[model samples]
Target chain A: MDADVEAARPWVAEASPTFITLIDQNHLLSSLYNMVNVPQAVWIDEQGRVVRPTETGGSIDILREFDPEAGAFKPEAMARAGAAKALYMEAVEDWARNGADSRFAYDPDAARQRVSRQTPETMLAHAKFQLGRHLASLGRVVEAEALFTECRELHPDSWNIFRETTEKMDTGIAAGEAFWGKVMGLGEKQYYASIDMDGMP
Target chain B: MTIVLTETSNSECVAAPSTTDLWLDADAVTAATGWTLKPEGFCKDDICVPTPADAENYVADGKVNVASFWRLMDRPAAASKDGDVWFLGEGATERNDALLSLEAPDFTLPDFSGKLHSLTDFRRQRVLLITWASW
Candidate 1:
C-alpha cells in the first residue's frame, strides 16, 4: 500500500485495474506482514488465512536492458529483479487457479512461521516509520527526518523505508548522488530479496 | 528536570525548560506520537485504541504526563534525568499483538475523493489488496 495516497492515485487512475486498491499512509502492512519493500504480495485464502508471507511482486520485464551509461541501475540488477518477478507472478497464477489446493499456497502455520522472522529492531523500525509519516503530515520536517533516518538505519534491508523517507524529504533517489551511491552499494541482484518458489507443492 | 531534545538520527541536541515532570499538551502529543486523544481513546487515522483507565491519573496542571501515557500503552520511553526533555520512541505493543493473531487489523481510510472505506467491508471475499505510492 502506498503512504503517498495522492501520488499513487494518478497511476491507479491510469491503469484502472478491476480490483480493490487501498491506501496505507501509515505503512501498517509493513509491520503486519513483515513487508520490507514495495510491490510485495501476500496471499490470502478464501477463509481469510494468509497463505503466503509477503514477497517481492513486480515485473520489470518492460525495462530495457540496464544501460549503466544512461541509467542509474545496473543491468544485472534489473535482470535479477525481473527473474524474481516472473517467478512470483507464476506462483500467483497457480494460487488463483487452484486456491487452497495450489502447491504455492502455504498453510497458516507455514505463513506465520515465515513472517515470524521479523526482529524487534524491524518492528521498531515500523513504528519509527509511522511516526515519521505522522510528523511529516503535520509539517514537522526536522522531527520527521530524524525518525525516518532512524527507520532506515534500524532496517537497512528495507529499501522502501529509505526511499519513502528520503523522497518525502526531497533527499532521495531524485537527489542523485546519495541515492545512486546507496543503490550501487546494494547490488541490483539483492535489490529485491529473491522469491522463494522452490518449496511449492 | 530539564527536557533535552536530542536528535537520535544525527545526534543533534536542544535543551528545553527544566522541570520535574514531562507535561506535553495534546497538540505536542499528537505531533510526537501521531496519536490524538479522542473520546473513544487515543486514535490515529481510522483506528482507535482505548485509553487506559489510569490515564486521568497522569494528567495534572492541565498537561498530559507523556511518560504515563506510554506506560498505559505498555510502551517504553526515555527521558533526561532532569526531566526537562523526553524522547518518545516507537511503541509496537498494539501492532505486534494484532499481527500475532494473523487476522488483518481493521482500519478505515479515505479515498481520493475523501470517501472512507473500511477493511472489514470486504470480509469473506478473496481480496487482492495492494498498496502503492507515487514515490
Candidate 2:
C-alpha cells in the first residue's frame, strides 16, 4: 500500500486495466497481512479466503546487478525482469481459470502455514509509522523523522514502513543507497521469498 | 494528552493507559480502544473479558486510563514515551485465528475516483489481489 495515491495514479492510468484500483495511504494491508514489501500478491478465493499468501508478483531482485554508476541495467537483468511478469501472471491465470482446484492454489493448511503473524513490535511499528506520516503531513518533519526511526528500528524487516520517506513510494521502485544496501545485504536470501510455483525463473 | 492511532485516522485521546498494565473501563476507553466497559466486563462483539478487580481507575478528571486495556485483554499495545499515542493491535490469538481459518483479512480502500471497495465485493469470484506501489 502507498501513502502517495496521487503519485501512483499515473501508473494506474498507464496500465489501463479493467480491474479496480484502490489506494491505501495508511499501509493497512501490510499491517493486516504482514506484508513486508511491495509488488506482492495475495490470492483470495471467492469466499474472501486467502488461498495463497504473499508472492513476489514476478519481481525478482533485478536491480542488484545494475551499475548505478553507469545508469544502465545489465541486458541479462532486463530480460529476466521482462519475463518476471509472465511467471506470476501464469500462476494467476491458472487460479482464475481453475479456482480452488488450480494446481497453484494452496490447500487450507498449506495456506495457513504461510501467513505470518503480526508481532507486538510490528504492531507498534505500524502505529509509529502511521503517526510519523501524520506528523509529516502536519509539517512536523523532525518529529516525524524520530518516529520513523523508531518504527524502522522496531520492524527492520518492513521495507514498506522503512521506505515511506524515500522516493515516490507509490511507484514500488525504491532507489538510492538505503534500498540498494538492503538488497545487496540480502546475499543468500531471495529478495521476495521465491514463489513456490515451479518454473520460477 | 493521549493520541490514538487507528488504521484510518488519528485523534487526540482524553485518557492515557497507566504503566501498571491494568486496563480500566471508561467512556474514553472505548472511544480510543473500542472495548466497551459493561457490568459483565469489557466486551467487543461476543467476546468479553472480565475487568480486573484492582482496576478501579476508570476515569480521572476528564482522562480515562485506556491504553493498557488491550494488553489486559491479551493483546499488545505501544505508546509514546509520555504514554500518549496508544497503538492498539489485535492479539496473536485473534490474528492467528484468522490465519488458521485462511480468511483473507477484509479491507475497504478507495479507488482513484474515490469510490470505496471492499475485498468482499468480489466474493464468490476468484480474485488476484495485487499490491503495488506507485513509487
Error of 2 at A112 (Å): 1.4
Compared with the true structure, the alpha-carbon lDDT of candidate 1 equals 0.61
The residue-by-residue lDDT of candidate 1 on A30-124, one tens digit each, is: 76666766677767656666677666665332233457587655757666666766776677778888888888887767767666456667766
DockQ of each: 0.20, 0.61
Pairs in steric clash, model 2: A46-B124, A169-B135, A170-B133, A170-B134, A170-B135, A171-B134, A171-B135, A172-B135
Worst 10 residues of 1 chain A by lDDT: A167-176
Query: Each candidate: what lDDT?
Result: 0.61, 0.72
Alpha-carbon DockQ of candidate 2: 0.61
TM-score of 2: 0.86
